[model samples]
Target: MMRFHISYLACAAAIIGAALTAAPTAAAHQTTHQTRHQTTRLVFPGQSIQRAVDAAQPGDTVLVTPGTYRESVTVSTPGLTLRGTGRETVIEPGTTKAADSCAEHGNGICVLGTKDRDVEGVTVASLTVRNFTGTGVFAMATDGLTVRNVTAVNNGVWGIAQERSVRGLFVKNTARDNGDAGLFLANTIKEEAGAADTQGTVVEHNRLEGNRIGITVRRLRNLTVAENHLTGNCAGVFVVGDENKPRAGALTVRDNTVADNNKSCPATARLEALQGSGIVLTGTEDTLVTGNHVTGNAGTSSLSGGIVLFKSFVGTPGERNRITDNTLEGNAPADLVDTDTGHDNTFTGNACTASRPAGLC
Candidate 1:
């Protein structure tokens, strides 16, 4: 009986030792899996920026050091932040030695955030994005994106293009001398056809200069554009909505200094057609253009005005707009033109340097 009890005790001790040994292996497997799923940070020293972005997981930060990275990048992941150590971190398109006939297709930074998952905390800050074959920063179908303290210049297309159902903040950025509009916001087919609204985009406190147009908006709702310095461009702000789809909505343009926008030289007459006026509102409703200093926007061939309003194609008169308390001067032709297509649009207390007939005012 003593021998049998000792044998039983030894077997039990062996079983306990096996359990103890297996516990650490099970725990290690779990820890390894969790580490794989955790947010990762990638540092780019001499490596390519695209490679770093490709290796980054969701919720990762790609901290780029000061260097000129000549490559176009596309980020499709959600919750990623791509930031530079300073404004000196430059990213541009790779130049090709091929003939100019070859069509180039790439942007400095392109974010295609289209999943049902929210693409939150995608911050791009303190970088210089330039000379891209496409837009400098293209935010398409994204939400909760932020761009700050960046400079976009000399792009083949728009400096910053926000399309589809993009809701985000664009602040303290400079866009200059791009081939297309400095900043453009448009609704894609998905947003326009779907029931969801592109309602929460804010463009503020930026400097736009020497572009075809400073800012252009189409088929957007509940947008605010204020306190921006738009100068030496073709036009300051162009707000037009799709009359066919009938999606024009509320926009507030106030407290901005729009001046000297049509500054393209006569030698660039072909390019001057793209220049913008102080403010051009077409086929839009429920807009307020007030408290702005609009001046010195002389179009290349035609007379430019501080504000030009046109009727909707659906024969609905442009209504419910308030043009008040704006200092309008130095633009060609007149400070404001109603075109007789709009009705019930009031202009009160607006200081206009160009005199008009009593009824026109």
Candidate 2:
């Protein structure tokens, strides 16, 4: 009798523990369903965008209908998706010269301006954010952020600026005619004297045009920039190392169509003589510039080239880079210029022609 009683007690204790573990999981599943499915559609017919973002919760969808929203929007919640109805959904400042004059200095849309990891997994899609005094869409110190099918034009600075440890998808966005670079990515190093590492970013299938620099990557690693059309910018792409950090590594620039950039006018009364190039790689290492069509770069006084590898500082020269399979043509003098003080950078299979090469059609 005593043995049977002890066995029964052991079985009862095991059952109770199992029940305790399963209870919390059931509650969590119910919470997830409540958060994700609870969506709110926001129509902005002369209303403010700030109001709609304030009313959103985690895992909620804010569907913005087709209209003009003349206020800045910031997303501080995690798992929130703000999607526009169509391309006509515009987000700009209320004033006319608000962007250029810096009268209203705010981002059109933002995810986590403050340094908090709580605001992750935010997505902004299918909107036209233009003419903002600051960045068009700024993602700072956030992870798993996605910006898709958005058009950002004529901003004072970068169209999309990702800073300080942001890992995300930026796809099918068009950034054009901005004053600075179209897209700027710098890992969230503080302005103080320290180094912060930004890594594992994918920038693909976008159009960057008419900006001072098409795309600029600073102090980054494990980055892939591919299949984008960079045209009519001062320089098609500029990759530089932060002098403070000096450890920018392993960028892949592949299969991009970089053409008609480096347009130079004569030195005006107010301005000095200007020049640009197709690709400017400065103080970077282990970069692959391959299979790109770079053409039509012109300079006013000097000659522009297809690729300019410039050595910025007096360290180990930018080495171990590969430039291969690119069709380089229509620049002034040569196709490639290596002004680097360092050595051992290889250039192979680059076809240069005075006219358009074959298979560019």
Candidate 3:
């Protein structure tokens, strides 16, 4: 009886082993119906960028060879990476300008995102965009977008702009001679939606020069602008509240070389009135401008200084804005300018050559 029981247990074990061995084969057969992923599409000069974009799928890369292509490309596909061979690959807007490109601004490269369609996880790298009618690279309503190693020169209004986009990264790019801010970020969502605070936009290790403003951040939360060389612009960095919402803050400007921003602005109707300053904080709260080397940003206006803090009627006062640990030297008029309305704004541990509100250093 013991031998019979042992034989029956051995048979049951053999059956279980057979089933386990066949399960993987069955799974592989079922997965055979899935489509194969598309490979990288190599595009030559004079090829249509839009065609390659249309044919690309998620996880596919469209790589353009080194040359000049006169085309305005629109990328609405998610998870697509459009990379050029190098800075020699220039993309110019084509002859027939689309009146409706880039939200009617007519951009060189537009990454579109909306309620129905979401264009997230897109990357534009290693290209030069010049002479576009609108922004060089415009990304709206996107998430996880990256723009790196690109040269945006002489674009219409902005060099690189992100509106209502979250988790964006703009690094190692050069934005020069743009009409407006070299790098811009703002929110398009209404404040009532409670999603106005788009977080984690990083602008680092870039050169912003010869623009209206070096860098501009508005209606954004948790922004980090660090280690950038902002020179020869109207303003080094401009952080302020938007006209409609007027309650934007939580910015960090540190470790930047803000110098020689003595550009002239003659009461322009459109340009930033506060020019020739290293860093300007208007209507902000809970901000930090620290560890920056600010010098030679001199102009005749009071707004031209090492750092200026003021309050606009657009939002709350400039409360709790700390300006500390910065190296301020030889700025015109004063090293620092503080208005009375900037309540609770402190300047401690600063090495300034001179200060407007004297003896604050």
User: Which pairs clash in the backbone of model 2?
Assistant: 164-188
Q: Judged by TM-score, which candidate is best?
A: 3
Q: Residue 139 deviation, candidate 2, in Å?
A: 1.6
Report lDDT (Cα) of residue 213, candidate 3.
87
Could you estimate the TM-score for every candidate?
0.79, 0.78, 0.84
Q: Model 1, 20: alpha-carbon shift in Å?
A: 37
Per-residue lDDT over 1-361 for candidate 3, one digit per residue giving the tens place of the 0 to 100 score:
4453334334333422321222112111110011245445556544677778887878777766667988788888888888886688899878765555553576888988886655789999989998986799988888889999999999978999988888889999999999888998877523432114666788999999998889988766688999999999988998876334435777798999999998875556533465678888877777899999999998876568889886654444677889999998888778888863756788999998788779866
Worst 10 residues of 3 by lDDT: 25-34
By lDDT: ranked, best first = 3, 1, 2
Reference-based lDDT, residue 214, model 2: 85
Q: Is candidate 2 or candidate 3 better by lDDT?
A: 3
Model 2 per-residue lDDT tens digits across residues 1-361: 4453334334333422321112112111111112225754343345555566677778786766567887777788888888775578888876544442223556778777465453688889988999887789887877778888889999987898887755677889999988677888876535622223445678889999888778888767778888999988877887775345545658798888888886553454522343556776777778899999888876642325677666644343577777788888777545677767656777778887542222221
Model 3 stretches with alpha carbons more than 4 Å out = 1-38, 189-195, 242-246, 270-274, 313-316
lDDT of 1 by residue, 85-114 (tens): 556788876654322221245577887765
Q: What would the TM-score be for candidate 3 when compared with the true structure?
A: 0.84
Root mean square deviation (Cα) for candidate 2: 13.6
